[model samples]
Target: MNNYLTPNFAFANMIPVHAQGSRVWDQAGKEYVDFSGGIAVNALGHCHPVLVDTLTDQAKKLWHASNIYTTEPAQQLAKLLVDHTFADKVFFANSGAEANEAAFKLARKYAYEHYGAQKNEIIACVNGFHGRTLFTVSVGGQSKYQEGFAPLPEGISHIPYNNIEALKNTINERTCAVVLELVQGESGVLPAQVEFVQAARQLCDQYQSLLVFDEVQTGMGRTGKLFAYEHYGVSPDILSSAKALGAGFPIGAMLTTDKVAPSFGVGSHGSTFGGNPLACAVGCAAFNIINDQKTYENINKQSQALINELNVIGQSTGLFKEVRGKGLLVGCVLTDQYTNQAGEITKIALEQGLMLLQAGGSVLRFAPSLLLTDEDRQEGIKRFEQACQNFLSHY
Candidate 1:
């Protein structure tokens, strides 16, 4: 038994002693392919040489400099974000939840200050995962996460993803923001239909409401673009990014255009460790590497290969109904007969020296490293095939 106090995480039995790139090793010397990539946080892969070097060099210089003082790493990273994307300003936080919290508050504040409190409704897609904070979970659109946390925050509404009609019906002059996931990562890797996303942009524009994209899971090259919005030719007024920003060093950021950024004025909102030097340094390194055109090409190719291979396996075994999502953030939707076995399939995959993640009850989410090597991909698929065969035998 451990001394930790936490809710059930359904942790794997294997305790990894070490990891490098796309592989992990247990204390017992069992090796496993790391396809989960710490739930998509290791965008550059585990202990990437460049990231490790950046973190170490920054550690030798400075680690934490509270929001009281500006830090160079933070400034550099912020500049990079501003230069590369639609954002004109950036605010750092420690996790996706904090970044999303900031985004939510900023949206409300901007609306309240500019348009009045009447325009304060936020609309998010059903089954879209944001973060674990009270405000985030309240606005996350999944009721089960908020069952015991009432009376939850008000003025937030949920809508079926990709239903442009429902979204149009929901948004009025009162709607303050519409938060969306280009690829819904937690429930299943459901990519937003292009038409629906374009409609969202139009609706927000028609109503003068802010469009927020919770890119916490789909950002930082997860979808073959620096941000998933690039794929659809739509951008969010407020974007929340994390998970992979620091490449395992822990960082989050809320980015917005200049017009809406000033709404978050001095002394309005802040965090102590939001722009820590260590996290920023690593984030900068990861951002520079991932922002490269070559990196995007590699991810697109690798993702297509994995998707093709998984479809081939599905066709051969009839185990999955469809494979969905973009770039490395793909999902294999299991056949109805095997829907409830997603967790068990993951466990058996572990037994076969593979690491995988399940989204909701039926979709197997593959959020592996953007730098996933050809060799690791082949090896992981081999392990997964064996695991599938083993699973079918029992079923």
Candidate 2:
């Protein structure tokens, strides 16, 4: 345990090794229900045969051909993403932060090219977690990640989440982009109001700024839709998607309409490992599987069931104030008395064979596999209850 080399993540003490569909086996062979899903990256669960086959098949065919020459898998993935979403063009990247970086750069470039330098400010919501990249960390409303990283990029501003009045007041001629997560993942799994999304879109249109949707945590059927933007019915001019996009494989994509696409011309921006064929191949397969209506419908059902069970547990134990979120991305807001126990509960849950996560303060977050079964969902909730009960008994 070298503290100097490793970064400090909250759950540093309890970590696991082997993983399967809805469960993982630790080094000591302790089986745990995996509710965290690698923070919403494992949409189809651990090592699904389909994804395994896709990855193996692609591995034999090709791995990397460099960005100079585009491969079939990359081209196919780009076309599929473009056809499915409001995007006319797609730029592949290696991670969610890279996707966001591309989206941010494109937004700024589009603004400067068309609307002048004043229209360079990027507006995001408070408590929203974009990523750990320097640019993203600064753009993110969370100041904690920005500490000691002085001289951050200027023109980034924060507005209240789900607040239309605040956005209307702040978003003016100088605004270049308004980035948001349809459901704020790191900030307590709060879904944005439909009206707020619409208003943001209208404001972007009026100001000629790009609307960037950072769908890294909510995309690829996490919300019973291929994309959360589908549920809101308000399309973003620029969208960044990652996490489940590759279904456990590392990949990301930034999508934009034709008008905003030209901002990244020949040498404007690119990534060496951005559109690697193997990643794209897996992404195509994952997209096809999660995009189906039946798959999403099952997700909706399981999400409701989990929420109901969590609420019942909360009512009985008086440990939670509320349970809210769309699909598998749920959060249990701890009651005032148990405020400090959020992290403690997660540790207890891990010890009791249930892996969980925390969002914001006093919120126990759950982002299981989108295709999690009814029985698995019940098992996770039941384990979580046991953890809560044990905590209550002790303290």
Candidate 3:
């Protein structure tokens, strides 16, 4: 009814509202399973008690403070991140795009300062969706986001994902950085092979280019690790994190080792609302809850459950051609007959009371909350299967 505040989304015609936990109630108050989890930002699900308390406590104490003065919440959150990850330093922002912006800037600055202006080119993988910022958009491989927004920033190159040879061929001495998503979430939940990631690291070293991991979608325990790089046992010089980092509270961060830390000085880069206490406090609470053995195990368990259930449904109906991805990030590839039906199925599933997402053109993607319960997992899948069946029957 109200399109003023909403841009036309791909599913604008049938999208509905009202969500909590693993379920949502639409405008008609019809109950639906929430398999989307706000595109995987709701790691703890809707209105998690821990996050609510943390946000409430911080809100009461302090909400907004200019960056002129440091706050304990931001400091503590940064400290926790540095302690847990490979980062020796951290910069906070309000979203994944902002975090990536910082990462891009830092990488370029490091290269310029250490080498020269000649080493300012950025190499990213094709189909990698970094962010929407001018610099990040150019750095990101997909041109759809950059369409009607050109001319894009210069000196950026894109290589195919998981193509070690292509990456090696493209990332050379003049390259300032190689940006990659450990798992390309929007491109279809495709996890880069370990050898590919490790080789990227080696090539960066060989070429003296900074390796930047855009872990915006795979961070904060979404991949059964605090950061997906941990799984491959290869660390990047710089890393960007967001999405589930705040468990639905908007926050983002760029983490870096000491080697690339000095490039970013005071006034070099800053966000007025970055590292605000309210978001950081909530982020700290979210991180504490997620960065644990039990939490990681839960992610793996729930992910396997969802994947297995979806596979069974796919096999039974032959609606899906393939299943891929890891931990909670998964994709159900629709058969050629069902490929064009992804958007249709999404609409029908919403009508049937189950929320889901799409990655690229031919897959029904699911990025549910990492801590989703087994019962909810099964129920969500059951509802999704029913929606698929209903749509197939209608067609």
Candidate 4:
């Protein structure tokens, strides 16, 4: 088959034709237990009934009106977010990159309007993953993403993540904002230390800089909480959320307090298809389902079960060095003997009817549904163990 799509992504061999709950079927009718969750976008699993109903109803009503006029679904969704979280205002976008772009711009604009033009620098965590936009990719710590995108945005620098001393030394009056992911999801599933987050809050306050949390991968109950910041007991000035926000629909949001919200005043930033009726309707449904206390409790319970299984697998096979991460977003770090073989293992797992992901080259990542059933969990683990055993036998 001649491929017409861009060559940016390394395409997988399987062609998934259908999915439901925690399972997906390829074109050849082969079934796979989906542990990737569409890279953490499918919070309620594929084709969740609530989200489906909401989308269908909204589709019949209205589709797009742009930002010229406000819609009921958008207003209702925004209110829901504000009521549940620390945000007093919300801005919707089409993707995580757009949400983060709005956040970075707001941080800079807020600083320039309140402080001055000189206070324009933005500090981010080293090895943090933000988004794919020019500004966001620059703000992201990885050099590989920024290799060809130069004359990239300036006034962005990175410090070693969780390094309180480095953060203390680097942030000052010139810094407009300090952006970080509560859980660095891409480079590796490394959660920020509590002390480090607290120090960041203190230092940002001391320097009058905004604290931005990129919760694109950790929001919407991925970490057994509605938001990852809840676990840390700290609040950010600006927060970006996506992935699971719309339960697999393409939607993103930037949230902030009233104090920092004014900087993004009229005509500052906008999105064309953002805050549309269909997307917001789905977002509202997903939020309602995920924000319950029972949901959080179940997520934590399922997370522990998954972790325990992974630990057992590690000990039995001697293939894993550590299993880390919060809630369903888990990472299994390979032992030194299997260095940089995460991708290979993922491919092998695919052959065994298990869908998995790799954070980089050394960490096998799992971002399953928050409501994963025990049956699916057992099946997934069985398939994954077989994949690991198969790989080991060859080695």
Q: Which one wins on lDDT?
A: 4
Summed backbone clashes in each candidate are 0, 0, 1, 0
Candidate 3 colliding pairs: 32-353
lDDT of 3 by residue, 1-395 (tens): 65665553544344457566777766766777888888989998888888888898888999889799889999999999999999999999999999999999999999999999999999998888988888888888887888888888899999989899998678778999999999888878888999999999899999999999999999998888898999999999999999998999999999999889999988999999999999999999999999988889999998888888999999998899889987888998989887667878888887776888988877888988877898888888888889989988988
Residue 366 Cα positional deviation in candidate 3, in Å, after optimal superposition: 0.8
**How does each model score on lDDT?**
0.93, 0.90, 0.88, 0.95
lDDT of 1: 0.93
Better of 3 and 4 by TM-score: 4
Q: Candidate 4 on 266-296: residue-level lDDT in tens?
A: 8989999989899999999999999998888
**TM-score of each model, paired residue for residue:** 0.98, 0.97, 0.97, 0.99
Name the runs in model 2 displaced over 4 angstroms.
1-5
Cα RMSD for candidates in order: 0.9, 1.4, 1.5, 0.7
TM-score of 2: 0.97
Measured on C-alpha atoms, candidate 3 has an lDDT of 0.88
- Looking at candidate 1, the ten consecutive residues that score lowest on lDDT are 1-10
When 1 and 3 are scored with lDDT, the better candidate is 1
Q: Give the Å error, residue 273, model 1.
A: 0.4
Model 1 residue 59 lDDT score = 91
User: Could you tell me how far off, in angstroms, the CA of residue 228 lies in candidate 2 after the best superposition?
Assistant: 0.5
Rank by lDDT, highest first: 4, 1, 2, 3
